[model samples]
Target: MGQTLYPAGCVLDRTGKPVTGFAGMGCEMSSEAIVRAPGAFVPGARYAQHRAEGANQVFVDVDAYGEFYHDYSPDHPMTMMRDRDNRLARLSLGMTHYQLVMGSENATAWSAGVVHYSHGTAQAHVSIVWKVKNDKDRFGGWWPSDRLPLFFKTFTPTEDEARLLFGAADRLPLFDAVFHDSVIASDRWEFGLMKVSGMEGARFARALLYGTPTIWPLDRQEVRRTGPWLKAAHDDFRIAHGWNAPVALTGFRWETADRLVQTTSFADGRTLTANFSSTPFQGLATHCVRVKRPEKAAIDLCPPALPTR
Candidate 1:
C-alpha cells in the first residue's frame, strides 16, 4: 500500500519531528491494498474509531482516480472503500471522497497513494486494499468472468467544484475528494496513491497497481448484494441494538450492463437479485473494474507492478 505526508509541503509528524521524507509508498499486492503517508497526520481519535467500525483505515494518506481508454487496452477496473458509516468523528462531511492529488508532476517525493474506488461506503475490496501480504489478505485477483469479476470506480462531480478547479476533471486522474476512505482514516497524515489514468484512465491506473495489462471489453455492467446486517444498520443508525456502525461485509448478485465488467459506480436500491458492481461515494472501484466494465474477455492477463508480500 502506498502512503504519504499530507498538507502538500513538508510537514511535521505527531512526534513534533519533521517527517523523514516527502512520502512513503507501500503495496500489499496480494491483498490488493495500497497506503501512502500524507503530509498531515491523522489524529489518534479518528484511527481509534476506524478500528471499531471495522472500516479499513491506514495511517497513510491516499488519493482517488478515474478511467481512460484506448485500443488493445480499453479500460481497467478498480475498487474503492471508505468510512461512510460515520465511524470516525474527525471528518464530518457527506461521505465525500478524499485525496485530491494536489500535485502530480510537482511533489519532490511525487504523489504516493492507493487509487481506484468502489463508490461503496463499506464494501471491502470494493474500496480495494492492495498491497496485501498474501493471498488470504485479498479477495483474489480481479478479473472478469461469470465465475469471477472485477470492479473499478467512476463519479459525477458537481458544477461548482468543477468551475473552481477550472477544469472538468480527468477521466483518468483521480482527486482525493471527501469520499476516499484512505485519506479520511489518516486525516492527511500519511499515505499516498498518486498517479493519473493513462490512455485507459483509471483502467490503466489499475494496470500500474496490478502490474499487468487490464482489458475491459464492451458494455460495462455490474450486479451487487448487501449483507443482512448492513441493510439493517444503514436504515436505522440510531437503533441501539443495531450495529454500532455500518459494517463492511460481502454478498453476491447477478449483473448486466451495456458492459458486463467490473465498475465503481454505485446505487443504493440494489438488491441480492439486482445488478451492481461498486458504490456511490467511492464509485465503481475494484481491481475487477478493468475486467468487468465490458461484456467479453480476451483472456489477456496482466500482472501487478510491484507484486509484494
Candidate 2:
C-alpha cells in the first residue's frame, strides 16, 4: 500500500504550483504463466479468442521487482501468499506464480515465485516468478532459487517506458522486457508445452502488450501516439454497454520503439536517456546513462598575474 497526496498544502515547485508527476520513485512487476494439458495441446496456435467449438485456457499474471535480494522474504503480502503456497505444496504442487511490489528507495520491496496444479491432474501446472525493487538502483540483485530455478541476468528498470532491458552483455531488447526471459526460456523446456497449449500468445502478452497488432505500428513509428480513435471507441463501447469510464481512468498512450537511443522528459525538469549498443560477440545491451544538470555560478578569485616587467 502507498500514501496519497492532498493538494491543499502539497509540496510545490519554485513556481508555487502543486508538484505533479511521479517522483521517479515507483516499481515495475511482470508475470508469465504456461498451462499445458498433456497431448491435447496444439502447436503454433493463436488463442486470444474462444472458438465456437472449444475454449482455450487463458491466464493473466502479475509481477514486481525490488532493489535487493532479501525483498523476496515473507514480509510483503504478495510474497507471504507465495511462501504460504510453497509450504503447503511441498514440491508436490511445484511453483506456478510470481509477484513483486517495489516502492521508492531501497527501503520497500517484495518478490516471489509460485507453483500450482492445473486441471484435475498434476500433469498440468503453472509457474510465476518475479522480482521487485526500488526505482533508482540500476544493477538488480542476483537470482534466487526459492521459487523457479534459473539464473536471471542483471537488469535495470526503465523510467516511464513500455520496455525492459536485461543481460550482462549488450542489453538485448526483451521485447516488452518487463518479464524475466529466463523464466520463459525455462518454460520452453517443458513437455511440448508451447506448441499445444495455446501458450504462445500468453507468453507474447507477457513481453509485448497487444502483441503484433499494436506493436507493428510502434515498430514503424518509433513513438507513442495518442488518437481520437481510442476516445471514440471507448465512448462507443461505454454507450453500447451503458457503462462509463472510471473517474480515475484518464487514458492510455500507444507506444513503440525501434531506435537504439531514446530520451524521456519528466514533468519535474528531469530528463533520462536510454543508451543502447551492440557488439559482434555480445549482441544487444543497454547501460544506465545519467543526465548532466546545469551547475551553479562560481567565483573566480585568481590573483592578478605578475607584471611582465
Candidate 3:
C-alpha cells in the first residue's frame, strides 16, 4: 500500500513545482496513483509531446504507448496502453452486462470497436472565420435567441475558404470505410444541423457519401421552421442507406476542373454516386446524385426534394 490512500495528486511542471492555474484548478491525478494506492483501474492519458522551444514542460515517453505518457511522478508510472485497455474493458463489461450502447465524444481508430457512436468525426472543427464571426464569446454562450444569428444562418465561405474547408484534398471518408456499419458517426453537437447553414448541401452530400447520421440540435422553433426538410432528409437517408450496412467499396475521381464524382458501395449491393461538378463544387456548393443497384430502380438525388436551406 502507498503512503496516501487518496490516489489523486498535484500535476507538476518541468521544474518539479505544482502546475497551479487560476483558482487552483490545474491539478490532475495520474493512473499510476490509482494502481499503486487503491489498486483500482487505470484511465488513459491524452496525447502529449515535448515543446521543442519551451522549458515549462518536459515530456516523458513510455515504452508501452509510444509518445504518450502519464504524469512524471514516480508513484504514477502507469503506461497509456494499460490505462486504455483498463478503461475499454470496463466499457465492454457494461455493454455486455447492461445491454447498453457505448459512445464517446471523439473516438480514435483504436476505440472504434468499443464505442457504438461518436461525435466530432464527421464534421470536426469550423474555420477560424466562422468562429470569429459567429461565436463572439469563446465559451459558446450565444444560445436561447429569437432565431439563429444572421452569421450562423447565411454566412457562406469564400472560394478559397470553401476549397480549404470542404474540398476533396482534405475531406476523406477513411473512418466510414472501416466502421460505418458498426459506429454511428456524426457532427459535434455544438455544430449540429442548422448551425452549418450555408454549407447544408455539402454537409448532407458528405454525410451520404460517408454513410453517417446527421446531428440536429432541435428546439420547438427550429422544429417548426425546418421540420419538413429535416423529415425529408432523414427519410431519404434511412431509405437509401440503412443504419447498419457496411461500406463495401468506394471510389473518388475528378472528371474536370470543377467536377468531381464519388461513389460509395454498401454491402447491400447499392452504389450511391455523388456528382460534385454539376455546379461550382465549393464549400457552399451542392451535388447531384444517382443511386444504382442490380435489380432496383435508379434513385436520383436532385434539386427539389433535398434540403438546401
Q: Using TM-score, give the best candidate's number.
A: 3
Worst 10 residues of 1 by lDDT: 187-196
**Distance from true position, residue 231, model 2, in Å?**
43
Q: Using alpha carbons, what is the TM-score of model 2?
A: 0.18
Candidate 1, after superposition: displacement of residue 300 in Å? 50
Give per-residue CA lDDT, model 3, range 216-240, as digits (tens).
Answer: 7676767766687577568768766
TM-score of 3: 0.69
lDDT of each: 0.24, 0.23, 0.55
Model 3, stretches more than 4 Å misplaced?
1-68, 124-156, 168-170, 243-259, 278-286, 302-309
The model with the greatest lDDT is 3
Name the runs in model 1 displaced over 4 angstroms: 1-138, 145-227, 240-309
Ordered by lDDT, highest first, the candidates read 3, 1, 2
